[model samples]
Target: MDLKDEFYSAVDAVHNNISFEATTANEISTFETSIRFLGGLLSAHDLSGDARLLAKARDVGDMLYKAFDTPERMPIPKWDFHAALDEGSVQGSPGQLLLAEMGSYSLDFTRLSLLTRDPKYHELAARITDLLYETQMTTKVPGLWPSHVGLTADSLDRGSDYTFGAEADSAYEYTAKMVALLGGQVGQYEEMYARSVDAAAKYLFYRPLNPGDEDILVSGTARSHAGSGAPWTETSAQHLSCFAGGMLALGGRLTGNKSHVDMGGKLARGCVWLYKGGPRGLLPEATMLVACPDAGDCAWERDIGVWHDALRRKYGTSKPVEDVIADNRLPQGWVNIYGGCYILRPEAIESVFVLYRVTGDRKLMDEAWEMWAAIDKATRTAMANSAVEDVNPPGGKRLRMSDSMESFWLSETLKYFYLLYSEPELMSLDEWVFNTEAHPLRRMLS
Candidate 1:
């Protein structure tokens, strides 16, 4: 079959096999439970209007919406979607993928609200956004904390903190995108979005020690409130795929701030450093030490350890995991299904699509083509039922195609990918794809 056929077949396979009956079932695979993933596919079909695909996508959304209806005002994430959901409620936390597939599912669900024109979807989206705003605003430094609780003074607690690179809590990219698209509807939220983006750019994107290294930004930043609270340990910083890049794009669009645009550009170019020194032209998935002018011999073991664990689980721990596998290795430049490797694929694709839309540069198409080539080769699985692998360091295991899917992963990857190959204005890229599928289908207080 051709690419489109392969894509549709893949989606069909997941829709037929994956059950969204219970939270446990949905939580099993990262992709299987993702509302955003399905939402993106649906959005694509909505634009494309391929009835079969839309039917398949709509079924998944229906199941997910049903599964999410519970005592919790929003969907109770069966997996690691929320950072502190175990402790209490998080009204403002955007939907996030905590390890590729599990965590909050709010971001994509909100988009679904907009698409279906279901008042409940909008109501939930608003509620969730409001809660997140309220939770975050009270903090003296909202930049330091990951997410917030409800609106009331008592509910307002700055107890939860997100380590940078922890995909779930890094609301910059998720919220930035949310606000950029939806801010017009909620006039009051415009300021909150502006402040949130400012906080993230100031705290996370801008590095103090490596101030001169315009290319260098730590993947995450956080403080240990338990002990003497000092600057979040520099050693704690590491680089993950497109964390800064996505947020930069999100922040730029939300605020119309050129600085954010500059930051995004610099961050994208700075990614080259991660590529230049590695075994291949591949960037390290994680690094314990940021490239400094001075000392550089910090134990990067923790950074690679997480990679190794992920590699082993996805590809098997029997071999060394090279940072980036070549195109010949796998269809998507990865040897395993760990989301980190392919996580940035969509972001890069989205960035390319956005640039092309803005600049009409064939070079943007060239970039998209190059990225697609790597993705197509590195990740050969059907788009709907696809999984990635690590093949560089031979003797590693192969990850089976499973149910670990997410709406964010699908929406971002596919929509961006499709946009590169097709037109934009005529296309329907719904907000719900990102909110409901990518996040729990709920909204914060407005």
Candidate 2:
């Protein structure tokens, strides 16, 4: 059958047979359900103007809303949907919750409210954002909340580790995007985003000690050090953290901050640099880099011996520096490959797509094309694309493939690649705001 026939058939199958209750898993992820399924249905409705999709989306929304029925009305990271529905039993929120899990529901929930004209959905989601804003400044680091936090009002400052990665990445991301999605009516999101970005620039972003001394920044973790009396930066980078580039660019344009847009460009280029310098022109899941003393004014280390010495010290290796260097065969600026696998992640391309839309720079498009080519070459299999077992393979040999494929390969990664080259006016940035999963929700603003 043709593509349009296949699309209609798939939608009909979902509308006729899909049921949230059919799953046998005891628990469900609030974040995953919201983005992958609810957001998908809503965006599909937005695109196809299908009332059936909206009905399906509303059913999922109602089921997910039960997750926020805790004592403090904070969402449980892992929700027991069966208990909530079958036994009328709901558990209290956990002592510590991931910021992303609690904070990432705004876009989907808010859009659900607007579409269904049900304020309850939006109200439940707004309460979470309200608590986040109230606690944003009072955290261990002012203006940015920690990766983990307590749900109760009394225990808001329960965790200290902070980063724009993993558990905390999308919280900051949603803040900026929410501003656009809500048409800037909510000033709190804009303020929260600006403060968090400012703090991140000062503490969480660092320049890598590369040969070119390129003016690019990568997001990293920070912790309060007792001896230094300040937060110390960890120069480890994650592919997941690459979304910060797009988040920064979108926020800058919405808030009219030129510097943020410029910084976004540099950060996007930094991810491209990682892809180009890797063993097979693909970024690993995680890597460590030698950090420059200053992010704004960085100079490359002149002594190659010093670079090797630093790596040895960082890894606490007893072997000779030369031997240490020979074992890893790391690229310049990279000290260690904490996670060498490539799991078909989409964050780098997500940033590239956003920056191209924001800047209209054709160079970003070229960079994106190179990234697509590398990924297609390295991951393609007979059945489908697989994850790379090692992005930094030894001996410059062929990359080893793992027999795994994540849903994001189709949901977010391929979507970004397609949108990168598609006409800009199709799902235009001004018209739609994407959730953390890259599902495009129609913007309410004119």
Candidate 2 per-residue C-alpha lDDT over 1-446 given as tens digits, one digit per residue, 9 for 90 to 100: 13777777889999899997657888889888998899999988987788999999999998887887878887777877777876756577565788888888888899999999999998988998888888887767778888878885557666667888888888889999999899889999999999999999888887777788788888888886324467778888999999999999999999999999998888888898889887678899998887776566776765455467678787676887667767787887788898999999999999999999999999988889999899999999999999999987777787889999999999899999999898999779999988888888888875
Q: lDDT by residue for model 1 over 386-435, one digit each (tens)?
A: 44332234444453333345444554566566666676442323232133
> Where is the poorest 10-residue window by lDDT in model 2?
224-233
Clashing pairs for model 2 are: none
> Quick one: RMSD of model 2?
2.1
Q: Report the error of model 1 at residue 392, Å.
A: 8.5
Report lDDT (CA) for all predictions: 0.45, 0.85
| Local error of candidate 2 at residue 386 (angstroms) | 0.5
After superposition, the stretches of candidate 2 with alpha carbons farther than 4 Å from their true spots are 88-90, 225-228, 301-306, 316-320, 395-397
Could you tally the backbone clashes for each prediction? Answer: 64, 0
Q: What is the C-alpha RMSD of each candidate to the true structure, in Å?
A: 10.0, 2.1
